[model samples]
Target: MVDQDIFDRLLQFRPSGAPVLSVYVGVDGGPSALRTKLESLVGEVLEQAEAEPSQALRRSLLSDVARVLDLAARGGPPEGSTVGIFACHRAGLYEEVVVPRRARDRAVVDATPYLRPLLAFLDESRRYCLVVLDRMQACLYELFMGELEGATIVVTPGKPGRPVGRDPSPAHRLFRETADVADEFIHATRAELLLVGGPEETVAAFLPFVPHHLRGRVAGTFAFDPRTMGPEQARCCAEAVVDRYERAEEASLVAEILDRVTTGGLGAAGIPWCLAAVNEEAVQFLLIDEEARASGSACDACGWLGLVGATCQRCGGPLRVTQDVIEEMGAAVIGASGRVEHVQAPTPLSQHSVAAFLRFDVPHSAAQVVG
Candidate 1:
C-alpha cells in the first residue's frame, strides 16, 4: 500500500539542477524472474543516461540509479504488481513505492518526477472496508480496489440481559459493542465505503448500531456465514457489493449529467465540450466511459485540445494527433485539481464517451455533437 503521507512528501520535493530519474518496472510473477529482469532494465536505463550531454550530471545520476539497483537487489520488489523508484542526487530525493495495479516499464529523466500514472491508479482505486459478523465471532476485512489486504477476528464482550421500555435489548447492546470495534478499525483503515455481511439477523441488528456517519457510507449488505466462509468467499462477496455500489453511483452520475445538459446547467456531454471545459479549468468532476476512445489532436504550443484539426485553430502551431483524447482530457482535469470518474460498461455515456460537471456553465453552443 502507498502511504498517503509519503506520497505527499514526494510530491513536495523541489527540482534541483540535475535531472531526476523516475523509473517504473513491472515485478509480477516469480520473485526470481523479476529480480533478473529488473537488473537488465536498470542497466539499459543507465547505459542510455551515460550518453547525455552533461558528463558530471550523468555520473551523479548513475550513482543514484546504482543506489536504486542496490536497494532492489537487497530487498527485492515489495508485494505488488509494479514498483516505482524516484531518485535524484541533486534534489536529495530517493523513494520506492509498491503499487497494486500493473504498470508498464518506463524510465524517464526529467526536471520533475513523472507521477501521472501513480496518481491515476490511486484515483481509480477507492478503498473499502468489509465487516463480517455473526453471533459468536466477527471479522473485519480491508479491501483496496477489490483486493483484500487481510482479515482479523474482532473481539467484543457479550451484553447484559434485555431491558423493557427505553432500555436497550441484550442483542442491541451486543451489536453496539461490535459496531464500536468495527468503527475503530474503519477509522484506522480510512475506508471510503463500508459493507457488512453475516447471518441475516445479526447484520440487521448491527446496522442500527453503526454510527450515523458510517451508516451513510454503507454500500450494501450481503449474506455470509462467517464461521463457514473462507477468504475467497469473503472476498467475492465484498467485491460484488462494491461492484453494485459503484455501478449505481456511475448510473446516478450519468443521469445527473444528462439532465444538466438538457437544462443548460452545470454539465456538458461529448468530447469537444468536455475538452473545452477541461481547458477552461471549469470541470468539477469528469465522467468518462471505461472503454471509450476519441482519436483527436492537441496543440503543443497553446495547449489547445480538440476532436479534429490538422493545425491548431486557436494557435497556428502544428497539431499532435493522439490515440485517445479522453486520456489527455483526464490528465488536464487532474492537473486542475478536479475529480474524475471512469464509468463502467453499459453506461448512458456510451454514445459520447466523455462528460463532465463544470464549476461554471459554458453555453450549449460550445458543445459539438460528434459520432
Candidate 2:
C-alpha cells in the first residue's frame, strides 16, 4: 500500500548521477497471468530502448527493469489492481507500490522518477470514520480508500438497578461515553466525513451527542443492524458517500478553473504558456485534462522545461525528451508545492487541454523559449 510516509519519501528524492526509470502498469490478472504480463512488458521496454542514445545508461536501466520483474515473479500476486515500480540503482532506490486504484500504463526515464499520478491518487483519496452505534455499544472504524483499516469498540456501562430516564443512569452515561469515543477519533485523524449507521432511533439519539463542530461534517446517516454489520459492509457504505463527495468537488474545481481563465486573473491556458510558467516556477495550481498528452524536453543541468528545445537555453545542457509531458509537468508542479486537479471528461477545458494559475505574469520577451 502507498501510505503517506512512502509518498513523502518519493517526493524528497533527487536526481543523483543517473536517470531513474519509473513504470506504472495495470496488472489486474490472476497470479500466473500477472507474472506473464509483467515479463512481456519488460521485454517490450528492452526492445523499445534498444536505440536509446546512451548505451551505458540503457544497459543499466534494463538490468534494473529485469531485477524488478524477477522480484515480482518471486512474490505472490499483488492485492491491488495496479502496481508502480520506481528504480534507480545508482541512487539505491527501488520500490514497488501496490495501490487499489488503476494507473496509466507507461514508462518514463528521466533524471528523477515520475510520480505525479501516484501522488495525485493519494491526494484525492479520503479517509473516513464509520461509527456504528446501538444502545449498548458504539463501534468506531477507520476506512481508507474504501478499505477497513482498524476499529475500536466502546460498550455502554450498565447500572442494572438504575432507572433509564435518570441523568446519572447507565443509559445517559452510555451515550456520553459513545460520544466521547467518537470525539477522540475525530481529533486523532482529523476526519471530516462521518458515516453514522445503526437503528434509526439510536442514530438519531447519537447525533445530538456529537460535538457541535463535527456535526456539519456528517455527510449522511444510514440504517444497519449493529449486531450483524461487518467491516466490508461498512466500507462499501462509506465509499458510496465518498464517491459522491469527490464528484461534486471535481465539478466545482473545473468550474473555478474555467472562470479564472476567462477573467485572465491568475489562470493560464494552452501548453506553451503553461510550460513557460512552469519553467519560471510561477504556477500555483495546475489543471490537467484527463486525455491530455504532450512530448517535451527537460534539462537537468539548469531545470529548464520546454518543447522546441533540444538543449538548455540557460546552461547549454542536453535536453531529455519525455513522451508524456503532462505527467512530467504534474511531477514538477508537485515538487514545487503546487496543487493539481484532473479535469474529468466532457468538460470545457478539453479544447485547451492544459491550464494553470500562475503566481506572476510572464513578460512577452521572456515567455517564448526557442530551440
What 10-residue stretch in candidate 2 is worst by lDDT? 362-371
Q: Over the full model, what C-alpha lDDT does candidate 2 score relative to the true structure?
A: 0.73
lDDT of 2 by residue, 1-371 (tens): 67666677676676675768777877665656666766766675677558668877677777778776775566654555577788877688887787776777677676677786786676666767788878888788876755777688877683345355656555456777777777788789877677788888988987887788778778778877878977677667667667666666766766786787687677677777788778888888888887778888877676677886777887888887767677767777877888887765457677877888788875434447633
lDDT of 1: 0.75
TM-score result, candidate 2: 0.80
Return the TM-score for each candidate structure.
0.68, 0.80
Which candidate leads in TM-score? 2
* Total backbone collisions, model 2: 0
The residue ranges of model 2 lying beyond 4 angstroms of the native Cα positions read: 1-19, 25-30, 52-55, 76-78, 90-92, 104-111, 134-136, 156-179, 198-209, 220-227, 314-316, 343-346, 358-371
